[model samples]
Target: MEKSEFDLIKSYFAPLASGYEEAFDLLNDAALISEKPQASTVVTMDTLIAGVHFLMSDPAGDIARKCLRVNLSDLAAMGAAAFGYSLSMAYNSQIDVGWVKEFTTALGEDQQRFSCHLIGGDTVVTPGPLTITITCFGSVARHQCLKRNTAEVGEDVWVSGDLGDSAAGLKLLNKELDVSDAEARAQLIHRYRVPEPRCDLGIELLQNAISRTAMDVSDGLLADLGHIARASNIAVELYEDKIPRSAAFSALMSSSPDLGLALAVTGGDDYEIVFTSDPAQEQAIQELSRKLSLKLSKIGKVVSGHGVRLICRNGKTFLPTKAGWTHF
Candidate 1:
């Protein structure tokens, strides 16, 4: 039986948006968004395609979570709290109603977890692989939104959560990396499939005035630091040893130390928050870490110069073949 787009929306997507009065039950062509007092809306979008952003064989529910989570991560970088999102799904012939049910179920779960709703979306058939695009909306205090890195030369650089687990996870999924421990392999793969966005940390950074500049680490740490340097017109001096890694990632890359180091900074997809702050805030950041029960590492500093410089333990500079992921 062929299901019309309206049928799918009425059955699944509409329920996701029902809590939001502005969504109009997904019956209208456009949904209305009511603005909150003294709040600025933050908008970000990400598109994930089968085999490009995720493996085709990945579970439908996992794929749905990944698609929404990536966009939410962007909002977190800007110190915004997610409110709603509009989805555009371009599904290929291989996708069916069961896959969509699994997918929307996951979206519903995350929507509740994040306290956001789906306002509207479009469903279309495509010859290409399954593609999911989400334009996520978030809100922050007026004039308190974190923009590009406003890092000052000599300020400390901090990143929330560990790095490289996702990259290592991808390698394991692709059969390019090997880990002897079954648990480590499972952890890495999970990181690749699901990312934890640092939304709470972002809100604190803005509301508590911890930092004025921040960005989510989507690309490798080095590549993203370069972005911060360019945006703030400052150089970054990174201490190689300061990069954070989970027990799982360290275990997986234990045998290949060199590869492990490279993957830690260049692997990307960690979805952690990286921000520059005054050195005085170090203690405050530590307190926040304890309060939030999240790991926050000070890995580098904003320096005077151009680009990023990574200093190894041997007092030598380590250069990677690639800085981060390049879409082209």
Candidate 2:
């Protein structure tokens, strides 16, 4: 017997709404939210297509987590705490009851881990590729959310975690690059599959007034930073040597230094936060990083200019052939 859409939702997704009373056990047509007097809701949506955002060969569980986490990354960029998310799925013949079970189970686990819950959503059959869209909602203190345009000249630009591993991982998965080291391969693949959202760090930055301007690094560092530059009406200068990279990524660079460096700056899918803070806040930011046990790299500075500039280790300006990822 084939499971109907309603049956699939009841058996798999409804349980994920367990702790959220407003979800009404997935029986109601809509979910409700009560006002938080001193907070504002932050909503973000991201859609993932099977072939475009992720590989069809990837596990169902990872695909589900990636969909949720990427939206969560947006919330983190705004320094908000995630509360709930509504998900919509367009499934193809490739997805069966077993696949739904695995997908929803992963979402359930991440909900608990991130202190959020499933609120409401829809599911439908698609003749095309399987697609997942998630609209995540979070809350921040009233009038305290971060914005890219708030950056000021002389403020230091900082980025959380390393970059480019996800791009490297993609190459590895596509067989464009071969890494014999088992550990390095696994690390890069994991980074590509599951990006760790800097939720805690974002919250701290906002609540403590450490940074006023920020955004998540989804579209490569250089491209994403360009967004900040345009928004704030300023230029940024980054030192190539200062851009953080994981040890595995650094080791991989040893084989093809130019390619590795380009990938690190121009590769997308790294969900780390890029923010700017006053130089006076430097020690405090460093202390916060130590307390959270997350690496925070001071990579660049905002200046009175138009765009981003990259300085090579040899004291020369480095020009990249490509700025970042683009879908056209």
Error of 1 at 250 (Å): 1.0
User: Any runs in candidate 1 off by more than 4 Å, and if so which?
Assistant: 321-328
All candidates: TM-score: 0.97, 0.97
- Best by lDDT, which number? 2
Per-residue alpha-carbon lDDT of candidate 1 for residues 30-79, written as tens digits (9 for 90 to 100): 99877877877888999999998899898999899999999999999998
Per-residue lDDT, model 2, residue 259, is 85
When summed lDDT is taken over every stretch of 10 residues in candidate 2, the lowest stretch is 319-328
Superposition error at 269 for model 1 (Å): 0.6
C-alpha lDDT score of every prediction, in listed order: 0.89, 0.90
Per-residue lDDT of model 2, residues 1-328, tens digit only = 1799889888999999989999999999999976489988998999999888898899888998899999999999999999999999998888888888888999998998999999999999899999899999999888779888998999999999999899999989999888889999999998999889999988999999999899999888888998999999999999999999999988877879878877887888999999999999999998999999999999999999987888989898766555443521
Give candidate 2's total backbone clashes: 0
